[model samples]
Target: MQSYDVRRLSEIAYDADNGVTAELSVVVPLYNYADVVIEALNSVVEQDLTAVSAIVVDDASTDRGGEQAARFLAQHSERFATARVVRHHRNQGLSMARNSGIAWSSEPYLFMLDADNRLRSPALSRLLAALQCSGAAFGYSQLRWFGEEDGIGVADVWDPARLSTGNYIDAMALIRRDALLAAGGYATLADDHGWEDYDLWCRFAELGFDGVFLPELLCEYRVHGASMLRSRTNDHFDALMAEMRLRHPALLCSSVVGVNP
Candidate 1:
């Protein structure tokens, strides 16, 4: 996790006069995906928004992926308003990684881009527009799956009722900074690693916040053997769902427990 100025997550802060200013912050949480992280960075640079910054959170990756991403951002500095890589002292889960990104972010909007995924087109402008005009908490679009899996990911207009069944919205969405902060960001559920996004949305629903769905496919979701969902066990899934239902009783019910996503 080396950078031009590598700082632990605890040490990084948003300095308004530090030459990094933006309307949106793109947070890419890096794990062990060294091979494809550069592609993700490239996609961020290709975004159709100029008043945007990029933050890549390195969760103490064992590989050199974090370093590679930092170097890539440095090499393409002109593409973004500002770009930098932040490091964690140890391997935290995805939720904490995103939380670190949120802490370092100083923008009105935020977008979560997984290290392995890529945007198919210039999406920031359209998603930002949808979020701005609809007065929604966030904006999400249909995802076109690629890699080991090839198809369109399940997507639907924002429906708070459907959240009790399962999460249909992916993490790759443009969200209002204030709304996300008010919801307390993503949660880190013990033994329920991959459901943070669902939990956040459920919290939003409880807070009476909803997202605007854009039907156009704007991003590519990479599915492979290493996907977090693939490694989850049936027992873990049941426990995770039950925990979610318990935590979000207002939005979830006993009938929704053990429901697979």
Candidate 2:
């Protein structure tokens, strides 16, 4: 996964001589996670699926995280049909990193993985099947709070009404790239530290795109003090919430129902 121009992504648009194109693309965004980026990518390349593409987005980290990711992807280059790494010259926030990956992906379905998190084996398979069978725009599975093995995060069934209150959708879910692009990839929040995932879910609900929930623990959410959401101070949260309200008041409703438009 050597770094490319970061602008060549096309959906299943690879050359015929390159054999079958990928069906799914996993975009990994990293920033100064040299110690954990390899493990994060390993979880992806180690998956059983073959028609998969992994895009490593090195978010202009001040560390060796990008180099480590490139080397690891290079070692496992043969595992996927197509894989590549794209590096940012300057530090763009997570939202930009993911939005760039979305722009550069050539697959119908996508999974946005953080450098510190990992996907469980067979989880992708299930999520893909759910999306295909239901003809939904995206699907997410239950998550396990890593280190809290005795406990699990059980996601409720699909409820568009509930989505308006708060975001229960973890960023690890598999989404249809088309729908994502249609609604707009992601919003750039103030200081680039907004609740991007929550904003995305709100937008999806607004678009009336079909969403599904699969009741299976398919990913692990690593808990640490340095996590993006955790690193923010209470003041940040208050400011972000106020901004969210100002930007998307309709999404903050409590009894919103029926996403069909």
Model 2 clashes, total count? 1
Native-to-model Cα distance after best TM-score fit, residue 52 in candidate 2, in Å: 0.7
All candidates' TM-scores?
Answer: 0.91, 0.86
Q: Which 10 residues in a row give candidate 2 its minimum summed lDDT? A: 8-17
lDDT string for model 2 (178-218, tens) is 88878778777884553787778877877888788888878
Off by over 4 Å in 1: 1-20, 257-261
Give a tens-digit lDDT track for model 1, residues 195-242: 888888889989999799999999888888877545656757777877
lDDT for each candidate structure: 0.80, 0.74
Instruction: Using TM-score, give the best candidate's number.
Output: 1
Clashes (N, CA, C under 3 Å) per candidate: 0, 1
